[model samples]
Target: VGVCVIPIRYIGRKMLARARVVQSSQGDLSSTLQENFSSQRDIRAFELEQQQIRLFRDRIRRYIQASIGAVRWQSLLTPLIEFVSAIAMAATLLVGNMNGMNMGDFAALATAMYLCYEPVKKLGAVHNKAETLNAGLERINHVLNAPDDVPEPENPRSPAAWKGEVEFRNVCFGYQQDSPVMRNIDLRIPSGQVVALVGPSGAGKTTFINLLCRFYDVLSGSVKVDGIDVREMSKKELLSHIALVSQYPVLFRGSVADNIRIGRPDASDAEVEEAGRMSAVDSFINETGEGYSRMIGEMGEGLSGGQRQRVSLARAFLKNAPILVLDEATASLDMKSEEQIQKEIERLASGRTTFIIAHRFSTIRMADRILVLEKGRVVADGTHEELMASSPLYRELYNKQQMVAEEEGGAPC
Candidate 1:
């Protein structure tokens, strides 16, 4: 019995190491497949089919090699234990003969030894299974034990009322500690004001909204909503008061009604339809003959970009939050679609604190206040007419956009 355990222990260690490698390689293969599947359109558009195929094949080869290594160690364990057991049985027989034991006594002793060896053999298999389970747990724990970059407050506060008033007081922040993306940002926005953020690419436009949503804590100073520090409020509670319509809206595999109902889960069917109608989703949806019941594919497949944006807009309308954020919300729409949705957006923005981030002058013109940002700082803040006169950067951006629109035979600002 003791001799049999020696081979099991040695092979068990080798199996454990190989099992870890097998799990890691399997994860890599899965990640590659998921990414390739999700970006199929881009792959075909850029003529990257062969390159992607080669990459996937390489990962598959590595996964197969790792799996074979683990199997080899596992297969070796049982056979080696069986051989050790045979040697032990032979020794027992020789000892019994030397001590002059009768055939019946030797037979009984051999049966008892065989019974003990059977359990030991099963233990080796159980050990191998245990190692495989441990490897999977290690991977799961890596994600489960990861640190939360933004943590919830222990004792959260709720305001008496939500007024949608936002203020940034000497706020400074950066993705990295040493380099600041936003510096000394001090601004006060009254409730129910329509504010627009204009900037060149990488000018911290998205980051500015990210901070207002409390996606990340500021490096210094504070951001306040209705005279309450955002850090003191529960993230869930704070987010409940705001609705965001992003540039690239994500839709799930469900009916149109289901996606819109995500904004307010308790919303009734009639309410969902009303919101959809307001956002112009009803126009095309009714043409399908299924209306709100029409099923959507993953990531809004089978739907045009404009249709997807309207669906996202419906969600925001259904939410009816006091604060509204439109991050290039109409970017995917055609001129007519943009004009139509722009009207609904204006109606929705009434009596709500609204923030718009857009490059189109037509959209920027709707804002009561336009903030021109450059390198994370607000270089200009005023109405569109005010910025055109005061801010060179804002003027240059508008002029360039005007030229591009003219070249494309679209309406000029």
Candidate 2:
């Protein structure tokens, strides 16, 4: 029961965010635009953003419909409970008749006992079943009405073209009130540099990335990009400057072409196919029975891990953003696949500010500078050779990754 309520946190957050979007767009939702909503506004446009909220509401409504069915099933149990109890009492009365107790005495007993049993049994049955359904309804209402995460401001300034310098000045943050995950983090990444972030689990490496994305604002201090506070920039403008490919790739249900085109929605078919070829997905796609038109199932289920990574790389290529974040983007690929993808990344990384987060030291060896983090602090920052001499933590992590590679009967670089 406790575990069941955990997912409600995310569900409630999404629903509330959607509600805000809808409320923000009401003035723009005119009768003329109602007929062809998509044609009138882009999904990110203020007017159409409310559709996400409506979709969320519809989802909850559908769940409520299903819950009603469950409630009916629960109610059916009440009649069964009464029937069983009544039958037991009736058998007791019949036995009394066979034992030669006077029929009048048995009739009096039955009449008096049933009067107590019926009301008591019915009330107990109704209350028990009602309580169970009440819990379900409470969870439903919680998910549908929980308060939202603090929202970004409306009509924020659109940031100018970025030079990719990022600064986190004396930042402190915690998801909860009493405990801070990152404490007084201060760092800077200059333009056109590749910085690698590496740390053990829960050391706040990913949290740093989240701050850069502004997914959650800092508790104190600021994250500035190109000398301007990221919080002041319009969310769309801030995100337009970056492309991210994480360890777990995400793909929607669509043809291969549609997946790649997500990076640049207006990309021509030729351009989309070319991006796939650059990512080394094109050769396999051409050999596929359906070519680029082949449908990728939910989350690219129909494709191999390597295939999915290549498609994600193709998306980054299509996005062609100035700031690139590769969060172990090639983590799951075979050596041959990694080598091919690395070449593509190297080609793209020129003249762009890149942040590479990798557990494998081999992946970060080529990075211009490695930022070693420990307990939310930058413990060491330098090149691979420099870190080997200066930081034992970096060396230990590097040697561990090397040991794993050797244990798998693979050659170490």
Candidate 3:
């Protein structure tokens, strides 16, 4: 039984790995198909994948338990081994009585046999269960006790006001160990200035923004807002002074009014509607016949990408913060929607520090200054005309964006 238990433990672990892989693969397939299908088709594919994974997991669990059950039966066989020894003892007694031999010798032989097998069998069963449970407990603790890579400061101060000055002092950072994403970066953004961050993918545009928001800390330097190190400020206090609009804006399941209200929860219905009007959202909201009361399903499911972006812009307008960060906020909008949203953003950017991360050269041509990042370092910093005149890399990116805009049947940038 002790030897058999070793094999059972190995088999159980193999089954557990197989089950985990099967479940994970099914989930991956569902997510991949979801990216390409309509809502109805996505739902059907997800349901089918879910069913297959559930059946596969149940079968694996049942098979592993059945293997355990067989080991348990093998363990119970030790009792039967004892019963056999007893019968042998009884035969010895009968023979002893018939031949006038000792009965005490037979009883002693039976007791010794039981003691040899019983403890080993019970110990095997106990060890088998303990090993299986230990594997499960190890996985649970790993997720629960993992430390945060970015932690809040122990004694943090709330920022009373942000003068909207952002500074990066010799910042160095990387997602991986040794390969720096951004290195030796120094930047100064004054209050009420619109600055554009333009670079190719992996050129550290997003990483720069992450550093500003303190999503990830710098390795060897610091980011300061209004002359105060961002790390010294509480997360909530730092965030309240900034409004961010992402390329993919996440809208909850609620009415259009409710979505705008997220920016300022205490805002009245009339204020929400005013934001919509400012973003030209009122036209679409009224046209859809739902007015402001129209529902936006999970993640703004029923709205077009442009529409969702407009709503997000409206939320930013409603927030009315001293600083705004736009991460390709207008990348999805049509010319008309872009024009409307750009107008609102420009209006909002007045007297506020705005960081615009844009791939479209046409959008950022009006930025007060553009910071060109390459391999996580600021290689060029100037106005559009100045960068085009001085930096070859900036010129290349500007020319590429102009070509793209021309291909889209628009005037060249």
Give the number of the best model, judged by TM-score. 1
For candidate 2, write residues 1-413 as lDDT tens digits: 12223233333343344333333343234332454443444555557557766864565565555555444544554455456556756776779968988878887877776676556545545554455445556556878888745456665765466778888999998878688878888888888888899988788877888888887788999998988887877777788888878668898899999998988899999989888888888778878678899899876868988789888888888888878888878887777677777777888887788989888766775689888888878889888889999999988998998998787665674
- Say which prediction, candidate 2 or candidate 3, comes out ahead on TM-score: 3
TM-score of each: 0.94, 0.65, 0.72
The 0-to-1 C-alpha lDDT of every candidate, in the order given, reads 0.90, 0.75, 0.78
In candidate 3, which residue pairs get closer than 3 Å at backbone N, Cα or C atoms, i.e. clash?
none
Clashes of each: 0, 0, 0
What lDDT tens digits, residue by residue, belong to model 3 across residues 1-413? 33444544554555445444444454555565454353555557667657655755666665566556545544554455455556655775677688876668766765775575666556545654555466556566888889977677899875566678999999999988788999999889998899999988789988888888888889988999988888988888788788888767999999999998888899999999989988778878898798999999987988988889888888888888888999988888887677667777788888999999988877786699999999888999999889999999999998888888888887676
Which prediction has the highest lDDT against the true structure?
1
Candidate 1 lDDT tens digits, 274-326: 99988899999999799999999999998999899999999999999999999
What candidate 3 gets wrong by more than 4 Å, as runs, is: 1-141
> Which residue ranges in model 2 land beyond 4 Å of their true spot?
1-150, 407-411
| TM-score, prediction 2 | 0.65
Which rank order by lDDT, best down to worst? 1, 3, 2
Least lDDT summed over 10 consecutive residues: which range in candidate 3? 15-24
Candidate 3 lDDT (Cα, whole model)?
0.78
Ranked candidates, highest TM-score first: 1, 3, 2
